[model samples]
Target: MEFSWLNWLYTAIAQVITWIHQAYSTFITPSSGLNWVLTIVTLTVLMRILIFPLFLKQMRSSKKMQELAPKVQELRKRYKDDKQRLNQEVMALYQGAGANPLGGCLPILAQFPIFISMFTVLNAIADPKRVSVFGMPADVVASAREAHIFSAGISDHFFSTQSVTSKIIIGFFVATSSLTTFLTVRQSVTRSIEQMPDNPMAQQQKILMYISPLFAFFSLNFPLGLILYWVTTNLWTLGQQHWYYSRHPMPKFDERGRLIPVEPKPGLLAKLRKSEPAPAEEPPPAKPEPKVVRNQPTRQPRSKRTGSKKS
Candidate 1:
């Protein structure tokens, strides 16, 4: 029998879920609605943990970009009229700085397939009729089947079922997802503006920063689980960005790529001392003439007496 790669991947994921169910069953007492919620939360945490290295890489790349912004701006100004020159200069700048503008996005792009796979697995597990060898309760599975992974409404309510409570819950999830998306985008926009150059490119980036959040709002109708995943990711990104900014305030660089030192302001004592001139040292006292002058003085007095007698 030929072994299919897809089959192998699905089996591996199923085994993982089985292991999780076993651990929950052994340790957690009374697997109730809340327990299911906890299970989902734990699953989300595990997924996040798996992607943490990528998250760190994204953040470091972003910081490098921030650090390189000044030099990039200088290049932009130098090659304002030459698009080809600008591109070359930008690539050269990235090479010299050991930074890649696309590095920040690569991690996110890499996770896309994994995210899709996880979604498929979760959807499959939630189905009531799905074979369960991992001690997953039939009712729990049925409840999961009823649960809309993306929306707050029960999957059974696809067409006609109407409950005010369900509507309210759905509304809350939608609002929460939209609000979190907006805030995350806003925070990033603010940071970008602070780092942006005074060029057309900066203006374009600022515009996108404001516009992207509105686009994100449209995504609220996606699966509730997906929203939950996104909310967690956005919150993590926001916290990380804040921490990075606070701890490592972007250093100012000059046109020549040298970091400009921030001069320390003088204190009160230093200011007062600045106005006073330093004291000058006094010169040594002069030495007295030698006593050899006495011999010359006696000879002069004898010549004067002889001249008076002659007169």
Candidate 2:
């Protein structure tokens, strides 16, 4: 290939892979299988860390949207059949509430390029034509290529092998990836519904949630590396969803279509009330009185009585 921009991109990705290999070699034992396993795990962790701030922003934006859903639906109902008015009302509502429906999506959209780059790097590293690292031979490289983070024989069919084992491995990965994606999408939609107002819009969202996963399943079969990426992303999303929902329970909505803070449960309040009252503050102890000398007063009294008797 000519040394074009694309070629440089590939070279840069290869360099990343090489750097990962070197990093693992230094910190991890030189065991053949262990090295590759650590590489994948380490890469996943690094990516997640890099995107942590975005993940947090996504979570906050999602919570804001959920809090705004009831008001949004009210606006939709108020502007029924008037598309322009409906959008205007929606935008106004978002603005007044200091929330944006599109903001939650920005972080996810931003991750696409990085995801593509990582996918390219992983695919390049697994290519049979790529050079082996650290004086490793072609056979060792081929063996490493054959091994997957999940299964050793999984790459056979996709890598052009015709063995029955290859078919089994490929089938497993495809099925596993699809299944994880489905579950992830299902959980997300369910959470949305739980947070949504009871209305036609909620029903529409529910339908889309179900439909989107089917689309995602068919679209993820380009490369085993991409499949891995999808699986990891889905798994990370699932964990994040669980953490978010648990920590931030859905807010209660009032008749005015505004979110209200959920009051502590009465049972919890009763328990809190039952706890012992704070101890009454004790008064500080009084200081003891000093001893008095009565002999000086007795002498003065005796001297005055003697002077009176003499007069």
Candidate 3:
């Protein structure tokens, strides 16, 4: 691939490392392995800090996307038969919420150029035959090549058949780097599951968990300086995420990836309702009948009967 466009990245990395080493040289040896190793670690921290805003945006976007998953699923069902239309609607939903399915990947993708450039620059530092146009002049290059973070050369690899002591030093960097990478990815995955188990990105994140740490172990043959940078980067990521998530906690989700709907809290009306029983309805009483009137015919009957007999 044509990476000429990435020359600027290499230059920036080289210059930063050069500046850091010069700054440290006031108190530390110019050729001290600790100086170069510390410079590399500092570079990782500086890069991460510069990109911290992007990291925050990426995280916020991921959260928003998860919250919008219900609507996204609705759109999918509505336009299941129309693939293109479904895509349009999904994107519309994302844009409406200022979220994107790929938003979480933006910061990572942005770092790729720097990552590649660091690899090249580290390799160049070990090779005296190469010339650098960046801040790394001949003398600086020589000092870096001769520097050692302990017994391991900044450019040495474990696979080069170096001595046992060198292997032990390189092995420490490799192990620390890989372990931190795993922890960082694991933290992300765990957070994702808690916040949005149904998030479409969660599955992709799981795959990255495996791929990221494995890639670290796979770099057993890579230069010690790059591995040192890797270790620092992971450490920064872990702390960065921990600090962010602590302040901006998200809602919990069920196993089905559904938000555990918060039960409405008791209010005045609800409290009164619980305290008082409902009034029971009653039926109206029936009306009474009037008394009947009767004549004194009872007494007249006897007398009338006598009179009629006489007539």
lDDT of all the models against the reference? 0.59, 0.62, 0.80
Indicate which candidate wins on lDDT: 3
Error of 1 at 97 (Å): 2.1
What's model 1's TM-score?
Answer: 0.66
Return the TM-score for each candidate structure: 0.66, 0.68, 0.73
Model 2 Cα lDDT, one tens digit per residue, 85-150: 998988887777777667657657866755666555545445666765333444445645655544
- Distance from true position, residue 18, model 2, in Å? 2.7
Per-residue alpha-carbon lDDT of candidate 1 for residues 48-126, written as tens digits (9 for 90 to 100): 6787787677667676777777778778789889999999988887778777667767657855755555455555554
Q: What ranking of all candidate models by lDDT puts the best one first?
A: 3, 2, 1
- Flag regions of model 2 displaced more than 4 Å: 1-13, 27-31, 130-159, 198-204, 211-221, 256-258, 263-311
TM-score, prediction 2? 0.68
lDDT of 3 by residue, 1-311 (tens): 32677778788888888899899988999898888877888888888888988998988898787677667667877998998999888888889899876777877887777788888887777666776545577778888888987788888878873589989988888889888999999998888777666667788888998888777877687888888888888888898888777656675466565776554445556779988977776767767777777665555665576776533
- Candidate 2, after superposition: displacement of residue 105 in Å? 2.7
How does residue 186 of candidate 3 score in lDDT? 94
TM-score of model 3 relative to the true fold? 0.73
